[model samples]
Target: MWRIFSFPLSQIHPAVLALQLHLPNKHMVRFREDDIMSNIVDRERDKRTMLTAFFLKNKADETKPKYLYKDFPKHYTWNGATRTWTPRILKPQRGRIVSANPAEGERYYLRLLLSNVKGPTSFEDLCTVNGVTYATFRKAALEIGLIENDDSLSQCLTEASLFQFPNALRRLFATIMIFCEPGDIRKLWNEHFNAMSEDHQLYCQSVERVQNMVLTDIRAILQSMGKNLTDFDLPNLTEEDLQYGIHREVQEEYGIVVEAEDLCAKDELNSDQKLIFDEIMTHVDNDRPGVFFIDGPGGTGKTFLYKALLAQVRSRGLIALATASSGAAANNMPGGRTAHSRFKIPICVDNNSVCNIKKQSGTAELIRSSKLIIWDEASMAKRQAIEAVDRTLQDIIGVTLPFGGKIMVMGGDFRQVLPVIKRGTRAQIVDSSLRMSPLWSITKKMRLTINMRALNDPWYCGFLLRVGDGTEQSIEGSYIRIPDNMTIPCTDRQNSITELINAVFPSLQNNVHSSDYIISRAILTTKNDSVDEINDKMIDMFQGEEKVYYSFDEAEDDHHNYYPTEFLNSLTVSGLPPHKLRLKIGCPIILLRNIDPSHGLCNGTRLICRGFQRNVIDAEIVVGQHTGKRVFLPRIPLCLSEDDMFPFKLKRKQFPIRLSFAMTINKAQGQTIPNVGVFLPDSVFSHGQLYVALSRGISRKNTKVLVHPAKDFKQPGVYTSNVVYREVLLDG
Candidate 1:
């Protein structure tokens, strides 16, 4: 953020007019780091530190110019005789490279050795001692007395096995083998083989077959990492095992279980949905290409249509890809994944950007072979992201048409949350939306007017349309007055949130372990701060002992420098969980990052804490297609986006989850909570935030509001702002 106030340059820094002449050939002088500043001969009377005999530093003055210079730091001199400040440059201390996470393992220790030992030109030079080279950085560090042991390697694997899947574990093992040389590879394998082969054993039901399958998988993993099993003291793979099919994409697709209920979902589609299903199925049956879009408001059965389409394609033993803009929405469908993960779309995209998918890659093959591609919540994605997918698909399928002339069906509600642009203007946000994409003009558009979720509450459905359309009656300018019956009388902050908790999660103490009871409700707020406040309050009020897990936070580039551990712990950033996570048994928690979404771990995925251990949280999925799935979540390092306010990258090592008694309005998007309580101590900030929050429930009776506006309330009831950018919004 640039300063709003500015002053003349002359006043900000010293003038360069009084710089003295220097003779570099005459002599050389040097001083200790402390002596230069502590010695009186090199110091000034006004507490200015002398960078050198010929240079001055205003280190005590924050208003003075400060530059992060690697060498020849610019310094200024206060010329007492001329009553002016002169500038000079002098060499200063240098810093070493570091990473964000302290527990990054062997490479972390190598970085430490490099920081201190110095002067090593090559990898061999760093590990050489007495004219002999060590095998690894771990050995060198041990010899140099930098550390005691490489025990963290075993500990890391043990912790990971408790949470990660067999495939993720194999990849991690391969990474460890490449980077770190463990003391006993055989011992490591013998101990963790159960975890690495758990699934194979379950399926094969024979010790020999399971071991062979596991070895084959590991062999394949090693080849991908440019290594072989022979490199380590591990068991060798058979000649047959050395050869694995290149049909990984085909295997994963066929593994998608198609239930009879999903197959029957097609028969239940409404008249409007049937038109879209038939139109898209016609192209699929004929082996033709087309792009189609299903536009609708919230609860118009977009997910229902997606299930019917997926079922139609998959039941016939064909491939169908289900993707959504957000992980929460993606979890709602069968075999759904976020578009970014599925397409390998770059996080930071531009007009010239294409997906990271290569023609020979498994993801590329998946896209090429899939019969139908269904992208839900398309409006929330950036145009560039969609464009990248289109370009990559065209290139992969060897076609000159949009999405490589593939059968594409996208769906979204334009009145809901659009693409989130950091510090963006109204025009920029609208321009970044999918509606602004060139493909939007060519795609066949379909609309669903029936609000299936609100079918029983037609009055509530009409009210939501008004909120979405910005045609609702306003009490104070753009601020809308919520119906009194739908709002809790705001007496105080504590009381209001307490009332909301009762309304949303009633009998919390009695029904803590009941997944069905807690899974159906949520409380929404506009800000992260408010979400934290309400969650903390809810956890404290609940009938259980809270367990706190603290994160190890670090700054990667050291641009922000080594912030104290205590200070780093106090930070809370968007899209990341808090540094100190407070969780309890049976309390609702939401995944902050997308970890194994196919197993139902993703952002906005709600889970119930079954148990808590030192390194992992034992939890059960309470929502979405993978309900009742008990899984373990290990402490993983999470970093902030590039647009973070910090000077450098901030990484925190903790479970990628947050308490979900209350969640932000943005996180609450693409979700339907049976009972919702909107807490509004602060008004909605961005466009469509108010409309999205109010329309999260099936009926007005189940949805309640708790508004204690920061501004003084003068006359009658609670009122909050309804921000609707009508220009980009479509009416039903």
Candidate 2:
């Protein structure tokens, strides 16, 4: 380099480097004067992009295409003219926290240890405790309390055995043994043997025969997971009781029972619902790749129609995946799961993205095998998530067709919250929704007009439509008038939060234990600060002794510990529980994460706190299909996503829950609250927020608005900002 500098310092052209310019060695970049390589790559990419965009935009020209798609580079490539590596691919960085499932065996233990341990060099370091090292990763994880014992496994069974049949319990036991990585299999079987073998015990005369039947059933379940009973610590099946195993679909279609009521739902569908039900059913019946979107507002029987369609397909022994964008909506239907959990959609997505589901994995098989997929609240999901599914299906099924030629039935109202873009504008939010997706043009559109909740009051229904459509006359910059019946004036003695809570949860002290009273009522606000203010005061007024749970927070990969404990604890984020979560024994709370959607533990799920322990929280599902079901929640290690606007990844280990007395408007989508109180400390900021908050209630009598203007408390009457991106409501 010195010899070249001495020979011709100013004469040599900057773009003289060969392919070695990409090497990160001691040599400086050759093209220092200008980014000639980048410019070359950009020009090439623009040309290729324009050629394709031109063809797509002007297909009517009927001219022969000059360039094929394969001519473009897939990723960074070598440019012959510039003699530098060209960046051709716009690779999308998918922000997803990769957590190991219990079924992954050693890797799961390692992940568990990693969540707690720091600065480990090798597997031996993780397995080592003091001077001695454990034989297995499981022993190591248990040694340091990184992974708890079989309590979760036992509770899972205890919860399942309440309504599940004996055979199902045994199957669950087998699944737990195989996938859950339970430390003591023999102990679990011994504890639940009676329930697992109850059916066989009734018929079999001898005790040995019942035990043998139970073990035989478990053996069959174990075989389905590609494991033998001998792999576990359970007793060997009796030769006489040993039998064949039945195959199960990856998505568990066989696990669902076709009840008489579910079957009768098809016949009871309303005329509007029947039309959608018939169209989707026909496509499934004929084995066609049909894409349909059922457009409807809240309380318009969308969930009712979804259930009917799911039952129809499941009744025919076909696999129907019922998924929703929000967990609240998912919990309303039978065999429902959140769309993200079902599809493995990336947490942070971009234009170029794909589903994280592996081709050989069970999830892939489920997608390929499923005859129907009903994605509820589709309007709320990001266009990239929808596109990711399309790309994944096309790749995995080896069929270039949309969604791998599967029938995808998505239903939602565009009037509600659209796809959330972090700090996104109106245009950004609208552009992120399915309305802008390429698939929207080809997808069949259906509408549901009859408002089942407000059908009696046509005026109220019309008013809601006007609010959502942004058609209501504005008082001041999108501020709309609140119906006098629904407005609650804030007074000096009674604060807005207290008044709002009182309206929603009447006789709170008396009805603390009543799930019906709590589940049907909630206070909706436009911001988290307002929600927190309401929750703090409400919890203080609540009867039971306050239970304060503090989160363990730290910045991951910060070896120097630049972020201190105090700073970490103070960081509050959306969709994450606060640093200090205070609760009472009977106070209703909402899940901040999807712990187990199948068991009614999901984000936005309402629960009544039954008991509290140092390591776990005992709660009861107070809403949706699993009402009154008890569940255990452990302190899980959760990290804020890459999109949380933090330089370093923030990890917080805490129970995924928050006080549900008040929640933001976005979280209230798809829920039917009988009594809702909207608190507006300021005007609603985002699109459809005002409409969603106001429309959550069943009627105006139960719905109340507590508007506390920041500067002007003396406004003529209660009036808050109603943000509606009317362009999104357009059919186009």
Candidate 3:
């Protein structure tokens, strides 16, 4: 059924299929076939004879093929259209082909035949057929002109086995090769090159560039091995070299550029404030030493402009220091220190120390070191105090003038209270003498006219702003509001106050306002029948918190004098004395005899707590630092004038020694809280005390006050009636 081609067959071994064909006119072709059938029996026999001879010669080497030829192809097909002929090129399709002494040309033909075969083959198959090592087969292919002599074979092999290696090993190999022979191996790329599109080619180029850069860096690293390098000595390279080197390389390949810039610029202020701040900055830039005063009523934005100026100075790399009269006020501004604490000025005690010039040198050194100094609450700072500070600066920095510390900014309103001092007439005279100096006269003064009060109620803002200003008209109506439920018996006033507090500040019952609530007990001066009983009750009331006491006699300093301890001892022998007891700052007591208020002696008036004093004998109580006076209260009431009503009746302690008391007027100087309940009793109406108390209400929405129901108590004067108040309310 089939037409068999008549051709001379070559007999080759099953394992070594090597046959070379000789065409007409020395045009040679090679193929290896072990299963081809020949129609001529004689030719088949000749094939068998050639294969046996080849096998016999190679039988000694076990690693090589046992025989070179066993079966060979005897048939062939010719294609006239292609002008070429096809032959079976693999074993089992033709008779084994024999090659007793294969020439280089014959070997090339055999390789071409092997490469053209349809089935898969291994390195061992090639070795068995060619009778050589795997490496030998590769070299022989190059030597016989079957494949290129360059590293194309190696590159192809690497690419084929790339996925077979571990990731780390592959990376290491790539690094080594990229660095060692970058240019020499560029042309020997494998299937990855043939498969890439135009876009991928660009990507590959970027990858190549990064690889080259890495190679260069590796060379540098090798040269610098074991050498020490500091951060300052390192090269200042661009971020492109630090991050995404491949991305940077890709961008370079695509001709893309990115630019980065630094951010450093000043911010603009509000329109009106801008003009004022700009002028200040101009003066500071010129290095002109002048006192710039920013005086405003409580609500005006003087502090905002001050901060803007500080910012401008900092932007120019200049230093500015801010200081205030007290620690509380110092904390209001950034980087602020208390003026007295910063200068180490001793607190004013007596007339001698108030005008003293011996402590000036140390203060001057601090002033010389600073460029700009801002003193807040300047109104509270006394003229004598300012003079002492100025003298100190003059002694150290040698300026001898008000602007001796360079640029100075003082901010305050003079409507507030003046400084407290002993020997009032002498202190005033000394203070006046310092203000007369010519150097103190020429500081530039700026007044803030615009009121930017943060209160929603206009009346409240107006009232606070006009407190110490004499020109402003007083609002006449009583601001105190006594709730309907507060009309309880006089004995229940404490319970009513407690109930009112709980209702007004419901959140304060928890932790929110815990620190703000403080209870103070009235001190008992007379050792009467009720004294021991009241002290026991007071001790029970102040059980958990700190209790402070003021003793009457030196002997009372012993534990036996304390009423709480006495009561507790009577009840139980092992009972402990109250542990949280501390002494109050100011406590009032009558002296055994009459003493003058002006002669540095405590008479009947209130004794303020200046602070404590120490001496060798013992630490004695210092009553008022302002007047340089001291006194201790006694358990027995001291009889004053015989004509005085109830001569034996104990006087109320002048200074409340139990706890600190900030009056309604003192509390009104600063911020307004969310809710405030004021107790305005009839006793608080004397000498504009009502006015001060009413102004302390601060806000209509947040403030509530309690007052007496009696119409007679509303009279004006020191005790003014409701007549002028009603008229003022109508006008408003």
Deviation from native of the Cα of residue 65 in model 2, angstroms: 79
- TM-score, model 1 to reference: 0.74
Candidate 3 residues 19-43, lDDT tens each?
Answer: 2322221223232344344323334
Residue 311 of model 3, lDDT score: 53
Say which candidate scores most in lDDT. 1
Model 3: ten consecutive residues of lowest lDDT: 256-265
Query: What is the Å distance of residue 691 in model 2 from its true position?
Result: 1.0
Off by over 4 Å in 1: 1-190, 194-210, 215-236, 239-246, 557-562, 710-715
Q: In model 3, state the lDDT of residue 570.
A: 21
581-638: candidate 2 lDDT, tens digit per residue: 8988888899987655666777889889887654556778888888877765656667
Residue 732 alpha-carbon offset, candidate 3, angstroms = 24
Candidate 2 regions off by >4 Å? Answer: 1-251, 557-561, 710-715
Put the candidates in TM-score order, highest first.
Answer: 1, 2, 3
Provide the TM-score for each candidate, comma-separated: 0.74, 0.69, 0.39
Q: lDDT of each structure? A: 0.74, 0.73, 0.37
Q: Locate the minimum summed-lDDT window of 10 residues in model 2.
A: 12-21
Shift of residue 656 alpha carbon in model 2, Å: 1.3
User: Model 2 misses residue 48 by how many Å?
Assistant: 78
